[model samples]
Target: MEKRYVLEWLDRAINEFNPTQTQSANFEDHRFKSFLKEVMDETARQIAYLKKLAFQYPKKRKFQEVLDLYFSALNNLIDNARLNLKLIASESVISKKALELVLASLADIHTFLLNRYTVSINPDEPLRKYNLAVPVIDFAQPTDNILLSNHPALASLIEDEFDAVFSTGNLANITPRQAKHWKDLNDQICTPEQQNPGDEYFCSLELLLIERNFNSTKFVKYLTNRFTSHMEEYASGNSIEKLAYIQKLFNQIPVIKGLAYDLQHDDLSLTINNWFICEIEFRSRSNTGKGREAPSTATKSNGCIKKTADKVLCKLTVDQLALFFKAADQSKIIAAKSLSAIFQAVAPYLSTPYKEDISHGSLRSKSYSVEGRDEEQLLSFLTKLTRQIEEL
Candidate 1:
């Protein structure tokens, strides 16, 4: 006979949570078991409801986040139950009350998960009412010959609009150094012949549309590429959470948003792709926007925007970051001995207001549940790790 694992027993208990119909010697024990079964029934009902919705709309991006959160919360509860099972099995005199702890813990997590899901996810009615149909832009077919003839004027208008967008400080909180880097890179993209490159035109067109602040064109790139089943895709190569933020940014006249949307839905051209990947290298050593009170307030606001951009640009999710930490722990990537130690070494850079608030359970959950600070923290931590790894 194969030896049963502790986790298997725990799973069985959770799956068949119904208590025996026979009355227990103690009335308290019978009542507690009855109550526990009701809680388990409700938990099962919620899970089934969510699972059905998830299955019905498997491709719904918004719903996917909620599903991930539910999964994370459920997994965390199960992990604790597994530990409880091991303890119960080890005892010479097993306490039935201790076994109840496994199911009891699920109640709190389930309640929390339900509350979060209810708050974050809106009803499908609102989303369905707002139709975002993609417009057809056939580059080969010109709708108007006269408009085509005035390409130079149109180009200049686009340039001026984008200039206004930059001036408004509404784009991703880019510093002087970053602005200069892009300017210099644009020059490099301009060929010796000075005839506009295909990618350069497309990139400009995207920026112009963003400057115009049209929602229809916001995800035009994604819709186009996805519709065409375009082989040239970048979103698959990056973190979906990060890419989601990038798309949100784009919807707000944000450069990071454009980059994120392009990276996700369409093929970002070689020039722009290089710019996106290498942008971290162009950091200015000193703070340029310092000293003045006005500049300081602007800097703080811009700082928030930059943090959002960084989160959008991040390639790794918290789960992926966790895996990296696990790998590093296994290989002794850092001199730190344990996973907790490795987390501690990097916590100052990644952890929130309180480093003590950083827990493995929470980090694991944030991977699925949407959290901006966690996304930003993971991105910063991963970027530092990647740079250091390159040196080694």
Candidate 2:
């Protein structure tokens, strides 16, 4: 809201980015260039930080430029289109820099959804406005805290070293005019955050991919040697041909394979519950005997398939399977609009206590067995893979 302060910072950033003719020729040094880049990145962080800050208040409203510039910066970073780059600025500095079209189609889809639903809104219940969403990688909160919280033996014991891994410090203290990366949001600053052998950080995308690869490789090896040898062939990417092949592979399994362990004991005997879920995904037909025509659509908010959805009939009894299969056969996924009709027909049988608050979407997570189970199995594989990764 401080126009003069923001303008001063903006001018400084712009000058650093592309020095004007009045500025001395000596300003074109490496350090100066680096400073400019830092300023530019910082500007983005400031804008993003302010946008996030606004959400914390009761009267939630974006400071107009927040969404516009947030997406604009992301578009620059990923070389993708911002929200309305074409409509707003066909020749924007940010638009000119964006070479990749990965997010353009997604933005178009969002735009279509917005326009399509904008007119159909109930006068009583006004549509809720959403701020621009940043990628999972760009959050101020580190996933290290979430994933590593349970591990007290190492994560906590090496307190000083753990803090060292997080490079950014004091995110909340960010000035509205200043830019700071997600790393700026640090818990502690004066800690031995430096890297030591056997205590490598898995914070960046490169490290994450390495971790994923390690797990995937180990699991594939275990699956091929211990279980099925043709898992690599079956459990591949979600190409249309691969999906068809995976469906055939899934069909070959007589019963859904799961390892049940004794979890709970009651006063009388034992009580069994499916605690850790392992589901699979499939490329089903459009209910018209079409091959891989209809994309696997889930009613789940997190893009996961609900455990109790029709897709999980494989683990059910013969009669139960038949009933779901009949219902599935009647349903058509290719025609997405047809889903409402299907929902109406199956409303009585769809899992209950029916309906959810604004928060929870699907009752279950996405645990599909399409190419067969991978998520939980992948997690199980990680323990072994972690050791192997350490060795490397």
Candidate 3:
């Protein structure tokens, strides 16, 4: 019979006999079951013939086209089996037979294709240089357990689609550029300094920019408006007056002009307020000179202050500092929050001794003396701290 005729017959037979509608009782109907089994067996035989034609008449366009049709029919059969498997929640002899047939069909197709193509091919030769035996979906491992646990239904569909494409040789590998993009994104978000600002305003900004493509103009405006509002409240005796100067500084920046307008228009007042508070905290820490400057030597207090400054600076690298500034330009809160976290986490080791003259009144009284013997302990502590931050 003509290959086209055989292909049409297989399609008609499958469409006429809906496996999904068949129940266990339908299996006991000898005539129906026998007819269905005969059609399935014939379809498998025709598929094998088409595979032979694919290789025997490689130059014939019709032969390849018929081969493709056979594969498509085979795929439909499997898809139907999958649907029935899902619908018939309770397993029975009929469902088991359907599953066995599906697996058999898959195995037959894989064997025929591999035997003709990949099995004898040289490993060093690129797989793409040959007729691709399988699609991209086949090559990927099953979706991770995390995905399955989080989204069971979606995971099942994803797996089915993945397996179907893979079995048919339809999928491809990730491109080099795609891999690089993911790697860069992972580094930006998962790094420690990015996660914890550690008294560095810029770190937080980098985090925001990396995580969210925050609008720079909008961010600056929000910061400025928040600062101004806070300052006005402080001046009117409704809030702390110490924050007034910082708020004033924030207002002077060109970025602050339209901030209040943006906040009200966009309904981001709460977000803006939170961001402003983080920025203020970061600025406070930075200005104290404890994390940024060399400690003073005018008093016994000066030595401790200098040591703390030296410790933090020594721990910081030029790359980290650059990332910090980049983060700051994106959002002060992001930079400040990240830096504050890092500083607080590492403060036990990085803190400078409180010199009476140089110490901020509160920190001065609480400062501890670091004896020469304690240097090793401090160094060990800083080393571990650096590693922890780097991992973040």
Candidate 4:
């Protein structure tokens, strides 16, 4: 008898002799006994047939393919026998036997047929020795247009804008203003047009300022708002948690005085000028009771603004600005260095005063002092300046 048929017959005998089915009367019947004997005989015949087939295919076919075919045939026969047993036997006995058979087959395959084939190997090529140094360009040195062309943000913006125009079939309608707006947005710089109403001239001016590396505190405020808007566009669920974490870090920065948030998208941007310039102070004087009332005085102060235009202008050049931009676009280290250099050069002349009693942790010290009348005048000046920048 073949090994497969012997195993099937043994399985049937084990199931019949098992005493666990004490509740079933069918196990004691003569008809069930006759059926079990027939199953054992059939299993013996299948095992003999498999043994004959295996010995006949000793060298005529690949061992792996022959094994697969033999196993497939045996599996079909075993499955059919199991189904027949399930139909005739009690539900509990059939279920237990089926599980045992499945487990036994898995174990047999794992032990006898695992890793029957070997995988071919390929050799790897030797590593080549080549110089990988990139040419270092100093921010202090003049940079050519070729360097600017490598700026990631600028390059990406140019490509995207070009593709947008090409795809929309509106290449002819593309103007310098639109190009400028795109450039400013790519650089995280804001134009006056973006803050107020969109206009071609202001957009162009924003581009010029970015190209020139001009430090506009007012402009930064507007740019922060723009960044907030952009971040909101991509934010969704769980973004609010992220925004809260960012705000915690942002609050630690001394220069960042206030933050405006877009909750719908969890977008946040710092308003540096909002803390320094737009801060308001209020004072009141009153007499308690009517007898021997003494005169009371109230005072208000503001922040300062100073600009050193000549100092800033003297330090700036097209090449330096281009290099600054290129570096700014590539890495935060480069951007911070360039920005610090520009700010240091312009700091002496660019100190502006706040027109209110704004505190910067110094007691009894005022950067800009203003009376009631002067307060109105300063507010008007600031409003005009804001409008002018917006219209640029």
Candidate 5:
């Protein structure tokens, strides 16, 4: 059987059999095997039904041709499912290998991923419309809690997916060129601009690179150089595309977390023209609580302000700013109205001074940013919030 049919069946299974948290409570090795068998049985019935339908319409000219292709495709899927089932059954217990096979099966069948792999369905016009599938009313799809449920076990699988910090099988290799190439990529991903999917992918790669302290610096340098050239070429014509890329990147690589330290460095002053980027970076950091628990205070942060020729800027890393705001932003005792008043009181001086948006992509939150432009406003906001809460 071509890979696509199995992939299609698997994709259907994933969408059809969404086992909820409650249903997943009783999943075991036996239950997993039962699922594979169930799909195989269901598939066999669909093929038989198609065969019966085909025979009844023997007078139809294209009937045998359609049945022949449908039977072959459906049977191929059943055979593959049987092979998977056989592999599952060979082990009396669900060993690591069995679990891995199951995971691979799930990954293989994911619908979005199916589009990327080579699909060899009956490309002919007649057969293209004839889907040899029965309505699957009662199939069981396993959930995460059922298979490889524990944290440690799952972590091991994730660890296997990584070869090194930035080196994964998912991406191809590149050669290093110059420092400028690396710097541009660093800026695009690290800066506070709205990143597209491609940029987000680069950001994810950068995060992994940072996590391992760039142990594979030589290889990373090569990728940086190649990526920088690509960015230069695409930045102008494909700016809008960058937005859609991030959504796709997240879908392709869904394990990113705690972007709590992308900022908070001395790599500023060069990009002050684009201060809004810094503002975006600051809010993002604060939201993740990266700076809130730090030993820094608003009064102290304000003290770091250096008198400049025209602008009143705080001499603080992006991280320090995030922390100051996060610390001030936390006040559990304040009334909602009072808090809004306090926030409006200190809306300037902060790099990214807007209140946190009341909602996020596809979800809503009751929080907003009340951060200040610098230490002074942050302190002022904090004082007003605290004072208002005390009076209340």
Candidate 6:
């Protein structure tokens, strides 16, 4: 059979089967179960033919059209079974045989993947071995635990779909022009106030690029829906706290986390900014960027101060500042609500008489003008804090 015919056949087969047409209410009727079995059996045969045409199809679009219909058939069948779980459980023989037909079709759609050589599914434990009853019900639930626990078949299907969609068959190469496009892209995505994209914005662009490159809105829709659901459950906070909240959610959710893992495996550069993009997209999608309160004037001013402070603070390398903060926090050398508070505590110990005049905004600013002696005082403070922490 040709591709178009297979598509029509599978579409018609799945749509035509109405479990509701039975004489009995619960689908316990013997004829109804038998008819379901026949439909499943014929659907399985049609899927096999569709699979063959998909494998023969050269173009990705044509291949995808067949593949989408293929998954649709499997999903619809599972959904039908799920809707009548009680009847399925009671009629063990027909359900078992009928479900096997669906499961067999669900196994390893290798033609859908970029790397056909790389087999992710375990041959030792095939899809047919699992108790379809447990997974059929679990597949209906929208929880990650169900995907991770009893729904290996569904998880495998999603993982395979992700790999197929995102995977580059060969090493992803970029021309100089493409590289320039990425640079321009970086600028285009920047906020109006900022001429250049920061690390956070750059990360957001990369996440968007992944969505663009694959041209898959399904993943993004799934991601945003899951993200919004998770975000709704979280306690409201400031932008940074909310960013942190999103990071936590991205790492916690299986599909999001799985995509990150797959990207890493695909040799994509994974960065902290990757998680930050979720907040950016979430805000764009939500319109008002709900859940996060706007920063007060003081906080906004503090950011401006930090930007200026960073100019002088840059003299002390990022690594040095990072080590100092980590050590300080680990040692409990300073108990403070914010970075400014930590700076305030240690500012008293600095040599400058004008230390008292340093604005909290300036302290909060990562950019601060520090002279040679003041830099020494900062280093000395770090040493003192480290020793104090070491003693503890």
Please report the candidate that would top TM-score against the real structure. Answer: 3
Q: Give per-model CA RMSD.
A: 25.0, 22.2, 20.9, 29.5, 22.3, 22.6
lDDT of 3: 0.41
TM-score of each model, in listed order: 0.21, 0.20, 0.27, 0.17, 0.21, 0.25
Kindly give the stretch of ten consecutive residues in candidate 5 with the minimal lDDT sum. 357-366
Q: Give the alpha carbon lDDT tens digit for every residue of 151-256 in model 3.
A: 3443344345334423435334322222233334334434445435422222343323313323334444644564566565453333323453443332222231
**lDDT for each residue of candidate 1 in 198-266, tens digit (9 for 90 to 100):** 231234434433443222332344433432343234343333333344434433333332222122122
In candidate 3, stretches whose alpha carbon ends up further than 4 angstroms from where it belongs are 1-25, 29-44, 55-63, 89-92, 117-392
- Cα-based RMSD of candidate 2: 22.2
How close to the true structure is residue 228 of candidate 5, measured as C-alpha lDDT?
Answer: 43
**lDDT leaderboard ranking:** 3, 1, 6, 5, 4, 2
Tens digits of per-residue lDDT, candidate 6, 284-338, equal 3354345237652221233342222222322222223434554466578756786
TM-score: model 2 vs. ground truth: 0.20
In order, candidate lDDTs are 0.40, 0.31, 0.41, 0.35, 0.36, 0.39
- Per-model clash counts, in order, read 1, 13, 38, 23, 15, 9
- lDDT (0-100) at residue 349 of candidate 5? 33
lDDT of 4 by residue, 78-196 (tens): 45445444544355564445434443443343233323211110011100101011222122101333323334343344344345633445543444333333443334332223233
Report the lDDT tens digits of candidate 2 across residue range 52-120: 534544352443344333334433432212322333334334422321122333344345433543332
Q: Residue 140's C-alpha lDDT in candidate 2? A: 18
